[model samples]
Target: MPYHEMDALHYVGPGWAVDDGFAAKVAAIVSSPGWVFDSFGYPQVRELLWEHADTVVWLDYSRSVIMPRVLRRSLRRTLLREPVFGGNRETLAGWFRRDHPAWWAWSQHAARRAAIHRLVHDPRFAHLRVIRFGAPEEADTWLYDLIHR
Candidate 1:
């Protein structure tokens, strides 16, 4: 769902989806049937999502694949001045900032990969079905197969 729509539905401030009480709000939202939630692995909501989720799809793309994509996306958004979540646009200066998406993804790549690796192998998550794809092509194939099946 779009961030603006989610914010309106959940009564959250713009760009506050990861703030305090977000997990509880998300938990409540995901309790309903036919809901699909996505996140960038916020630890606060991970357990709740894991407990309630039927299937987990992990896009385990490597840094080599992810870094270029992130850079390209940031460039496109900045150049186009596209309005993202909550009517916020990515500025060219933001690309050089430490909090930029490209920088964040690059910095967190190893830790994120480690966490996902642990989650996939941990016996605690055995009850949850996990589909991990190392490449974009693999993810596309999986989705195609799922839709066709």
Candidate 2:
């Protein structure tokens, strides 16, 4: 999305200390036109973003799908010392340490996916157009259609 547009994008995590600052930064950018905030994670902020976003693309993939992907990504990052959000890096020590976000997300995968399902189906989100993709191929096709249209 950023490649197609030079809009300010804010990524919100489950951490309030991180998300609060991020939300503030987003608010500042949104004051101007043509800026888009693309956040990942954080069901707590769903309503806030839903109100502003005309579209919501959900990759409602299974835990089996997401877990392996997250595991591989984390391991690769940890091994490569790749810089992630805010100049921080992932580490194997962090993954096994039990306090990492990846661990938390993996632990609460079922509950989190359920909550997202509820929120998206609830009448409160009726104003938002949701596109749910069950498979990676379908997701890519749908995204392609949207972009092309």
Candidate 3:
């Protein structure tokens, strides 16, 4: 779902058949070959995506590293009034909200890391090839090598 739709959903709440439709969209995407996702994280679609995915690239960065980057990105987007997902722009007030990416990143860092770690080791997902990068440099190097290869 787009950020605007998600924002609207936060206000209107669920039970609108949006999630069901999103699941169908996810299913369709995963059924195809050679697709990529910035994230396939929503609980409604995670299972299907994970089950079909052959590889997982996990970025396990420290909160100190993550919080600053999120804050900077959010601030830049908010200040410039840049249209983000689905033409939604970040607002300064939204920055304070618990659901804001910056806040959410900081607050959920540990829990999210732990959760991903559990998923990485879970027997159900053992077929997946998981490549975990603890720093930006590591990820960049991997991408560089991948591209050069």
Q: Which candidate is the best by lDDT?
A: 3
Better of 2 and 3 by lDDT: 3
Q: Write the per-residue lDDT of candidate 3 for residues 1-149, one digit (tens) a residue.
A: 22213333222322222333566666777788766666637766666767988998898889888888988999999999976654477898887788799878888888888878888889999999999999999999999999999
Best-fitting candidate, measured by TM-score?
3
RMSD from true fold, candidate 3: 4.8
Q: 83-110, model 1: which lDDT tens digit per residue?
A: 6664567787787878788999999999
TM-score between model 2 and native? 0.75
**How does model 3 score by TM-score?**
0.84
Q: Candidate 2's error at 11, in angstroms? A: 8.9
For each candidate, the alpha-carbon lDDT, in order, equals 0.73, 0.64, 0.74
What does the lDDT read for residue 122 in candidate 2? 81
Query: Residue-wise lDDT of candidate 2 within 1-149, one digit each (tens)?
Result: 22211112232332212534655554444444443444443454456666666677777788778888888888889989986664567766787767575787688778867877887888877987887888888998877897999
Better of 1 and 2 by TM-score: 1
What order do you get sorting by lDDT, best first? 3, 1, 2
